[model samples]
Target: MGIRSTLPLCAVVAGTAALQIPLLSPHQQAPLEAADKTKPLINSSALQDLISGDRLFTRAKKLFDIAKLGEDEYNHPTRVIGSAGHEGTLAYIYESILQLGDYYKLDNQSFPAVSGNVFESRLVIGNSVSKSAAPMGLTPPTQNKQPVHGDLVLVENEGCQIGDFPDSVSGNIAFIKRGTCPFGTKSEHAGQKGATAAIVYNYEKDAVQGTLGTPSPNHVATFGLSGKEAGPVLEKLEKKDKVDAIAYIDADVKQIITRNIIAQTSEGDPNNCVMLGAHSDSVAEGPGINDDGSGSISLLEVATQLTKFNVSNCVRFAWWAGEEEGLLGSDYYVATLPEEENIKIRLFMDYDMMASPNFAYQIYNATNAVNPNGSEELRDLYIDWYKDQGLNYTFIPFDGRSDYDGFIRGGIPGGGIATGAEGIKTKEEEKQFGGKAGEWYDHCYHQLCDDLSNVNMTAWIVNTKLIAHSVGTYARSFKGFPKRTSSVASSAYESEAKYHGSMLYI
Candidate 1:
């Protein structure tokens, strides 16, 4: 509950000159080609010469190398909040933008985020142990390593509602099956029932993994167990045999301030800005290269290459921190934006997990009525983009998951692309995007294996090129896009923001 911070965030210069630039890492040694430096201001077709699969792959490798340094030097491998890897990633991105000269106004808005890391955590059944078990995101460390043991009590299929938890679950661990609710809600209900702890088993084949969405006093300490682990615990309990279990969770929670890197072209109409954003932090496990490194670096490279161009409408790029921690960075930015500042956003775009290993040509399905007025226009833009390339594309609903949640809530039209996450791919999706069916879009979605090799270079190249195209298009014109409104309330976001009983996000 250590939440408030009095420290003023470091106001990063937006489109400002550099004070000092860090030396590039060894892996980031590619020389700026003569064409790269002198490339004339252009429209979207310039993507052909500026970015390619090879370049993106090489840059991603360099990003992985940078992530490695966090493990080697700072002892935190992944780019999670307050980790060395995350700090380094931010610095690398900042330097990349600073190197672009006077092309954009550069600003780093630093703010405190309630972020933490697990020191030592575990969940073990009386017999079989699932190494894949992960602590929920943003779990407070109060229950550190103190093993809580109980006869596993299985609530209804989903222990989401207070009524779903039985009175008998009091003084025991509530073994809840996950569905139809936020993981935090399940934990909150079980805790309200006087349960010692809560264990949420995945409704899907994979292990249950996700955050409580935000810090809540009502939520008790909880751990995620795989379906494999939960099945046995339930079976043993059903057979009247003792199904004893112990869960150990320890984390250090602190109010740590992180930066949001925002850079915008100076020549364009500042009153009407087009925004692009991607989270800069990873999870607690590996160097979340593909989970976000691909997206983060995609914007970085595009921002660098964009320096040669003159934009008509200001193009603002943001590298947000604390997305894996529940979209805190971007959420804070949007929530605190002044009336004038909020209205300037012509439209907002988010790019996250764009290069999942088993990639998909997925666009945010803003075509639905749940989205803001102009979301469909953004969706159509991406549909036309992939269709023009003869690529098979599909629509991913505009759920309040990812960094765009805040923008959508601020009444801004939002759309972006994703390459899928932990969800399993159907045979139909395989036919559409062409990878092994039945496999997770990113086999290493949030695990330690999400390293340098996790990206599908084809997806990386195409999606980033699409980003370049969008930036160039919007940077030059907002002719067909929806006009900015004065009000800041988003009906779609308000409907979706209180995700009390939704089980779809992490």
Candidate 2:
């Protein structure tokens, strides 16, 4: 959850200045040139092998089509490591990987996967107190459902500062902002100040409108409130007025065990690795088929197929558990890695939601601001592949919204493909894509309706095949990475925006 990589790549400048500026010094340029010259290039044999990998697709479809998985099955819930849902999902994935590994002769290892979960809490507003609200993921579960009523402490900035909480906040719930610093930090600070609970309001600058923050590690319950709702409470707190509010942060959530499924090629060395990962967990409320079932199936097929094929790159596959509960499995895996193992990861391809009936395929471009992620060479290679395939995609910045966040933060090159979700398509995009501009890309994105029946098989299958082909291409002949381009300012974004129109939150 903390920031991952400390390695600094060159920052990208824009327009005229960037064009005139040289990125490397004379000495660095020579090494870079020499490295590029010695790198391998993709060969036709690998492409043929990838194209012929039908067994992988068959297996992937089987898992994706099956909807029996609950949060702990193919789809994980909010449970992190040690939760039944988390553990169950992990166990299933682990079994799948073991099967694939044994069949393919790949050396696979299982490590401890763990996460924090809150089991209890108490909220008291005025005279009424009840444990009706459960803290969100990464927030601590309430220690006691004890009713604690006092003046509500509203911290204006997302970061808890000196004046944010007064002494009156003792035995009170502190409301904090969700920008400037991580929500977890602010919540932890409030808890250190003897605050009973924390409510994080979404930052005004955030495009995603919601009051969101991490839970307290010290078992402090945290709630996310909208800016509209938190504003008045903050105003009252600033006035030093006594306020009555109900606070209950308790849940039946319990600790349990979980596992991560992994499969690798027998011929490859673990020292140099290529990882492809996707979480098999879903939100607790729904089946989360498209949210990840699509991705799971895609990777399953890819991994299964890899077991049968012979490739030069050491490829590994992972089906993570507890992704719904704040990336527990992936986080644990990344955190436990030795420095060398972490750096040996040449690329990490994350497939979250690959097939959506409503949205066109959208690739997570590492060059996007949300990610500004991975090695430049990795992104360029993938981008070039997309172009060659004539696939339609929109590049967004890296925001650590998925499992790939861990690898990306660690400075590994990461890129994945996703189809549209809730975002509206622009007019220009509509012209290109020919869909209703302001409709949800996948109406069943996170609901039970997201079963296999809701997915567009053509899209799913095509995209899955594309992923296999792309990965194989990279595995066969990757050399030095491509030049990094930071802060890609696209002239086409406006045109695309005009076509898609504004997002409609239905």
Candidate 3:
């Protein structure tokens, strides 16, 4: 298929107010409210009511604080995969749900993922050295930890095609602007043109934190520079001035084991499961509170509240890891799952960014789905909820930019909501959503500033309510929802699918 496309609890851990997470048990079961036969069926209103902004914020704060408990060698405050922060996130989710007793079956599915850690990255131009450079994820490090020294040659037209690289680029560093193509593609093109390295600068003011999708033989060591840092070099190049530079990136890219938390309601029919997911890991730069901590905590709140009632269809919640690097955790789960188990999933909903400060109620536009089995219905359900609530909403393409990509590729219909991401809010959206038209939905997205202050509490609560509504509706019944059928082969999506986050588009 081608797509287009926190409850606060305070606990002291390591001098930080982290969540009071308990030790994980292989399996634990205790009687909960779902056991009573007289319990009422889950409804949207009830489920939504259980979602408290105060509670959610509390939890979000705790998650942010936990990220401060770094385990990586750098020990920065990050919840990136293979770090203590991520493990703490997993433990917190397990302990939170454990409070619900035996209502759900929880499992931590472990897998190894190739994670890239950039030890050093910089762009040295004349006497000016900018250490604000970051290596694109999954990109190869400079050979022998050596810097690539060459004259900076600006690639024309965003450097998406071979023609963009001038003959003068041979043995030089390709100075490219980010847009229109994957960073990998640009790097590959630069390598093909005999460029010693590629330096892709962001179009936005912020530093470029992107991925090359995967390692490629044609890719040379690549680095990214923010618009501010690259401005002087760009001005010099535009004026036809000779700008010599040194690009260096020392990174360690290796496969490391991580785990995904999968929990399903034990009370419902497992044959027809309504699945929801949010990435548990953050980018290495910061605590991913708004990026996905909002979504992760939303699921936790919903799961805890759902213990009050039973469901007809099983509701499964997943905290996927390695989402920031790529959709590695969810992809691994879908790839390893047996077809018999796979077919049992009725629909999958992904909630990635739920609380962009300058937010919009953007639902996943399932109309562009590669496999439209039950996707539109899922989208319409959220749309209908928004309409009923008298909220203005818009659509974002199903561009295989989130965790929903794997399920949709497997012919399982998928849909969900997002506040928004790096996309600048348009004037029309501004009128509809009451946010600044020219600013990014979340200005702090993927940056160290994406901490507790980055979130919009109002939008977070509303989006969480929407998630509850959708989860409750699907859990109660699948009436009128289309049955799963053979979708376009997974191979069909291989060519066009974008594995990176929402910011990068084909």
lDDT by residue for model 3 (306-389), tens: 888877666889999999888988888888866766777788999998999999999987753445478888889998988998
Superposed model 3: Cα runs more than 4 Å off: 1-35, 71-75, 124-134, 144-146, 151-195, 200-209, 216-219, 224-244, 489-499, 502-506
Per-residue lDDT of candidate 2, residues 1-506 (tens digit): 11212231111111211333243221121111111234333343344345332443454445443334334432533222343543444454555655653333222234443344334554454454422323545455455555444456766555446466566666877766665544556666777778877766654422222212323354356665555555555676678776666566544344545556555554433335568888876655455667777677677666655554455555667777766666666766777666645655667887877767766756655563334334445556556666777866667544456777666555556777777766667776666555667777787755556655666666676677777776676555345543223232233322222110111000
Which scores better on lDDT, 1 or 3? 3
Global local distance difference test of model 1:
0.74
Give the best candidate by lDDT: 3
Q: Which ten residues in a row have the lowest lDDT in candidate 1?
A: 24-33
Q: TM-score: which is higher, 2 or 3?
A: 3
Tell me the lDDT of candidate 2: 0.54
In model 2, what lDDT does residue 36 have?
24
Q: State the C-alpha lDDT per candidate.
A: 0.74, 0.54, 0.80
**Tens digit of lDDT per residue, candidate 1, span 1-506?**
11222432212322121232222221122121222335444587885458867777777777787777668643646777787778878888888777776676667778888775777877777765657677776666534447777767778768766998889788787888876667878888888898877888875567766677667776777778777766766777767676766777777667788988877765555566789999889877779988798899889888878877656556789999888777888988988887656777778999998899888888887743676567788888888989999999987766677888788777778889999987788899898889989898999987788987788888888899899988887776666677766554456555555431112442
Ranking by TM-score: 1, 3, 2
User: Regarding TM-score, does 1 or 3 come out ahead?
Assistant: 1
Candidate 1 regions with alpha-carbon error over 4 angstroms: 1-42, 72-76, 119-121, 124-133, 141-144, 153-170, 176-181, 192-194, 201-207, 225-244, 486-506
How do all models score by TM-score? 0.82, 0.71, 0.80
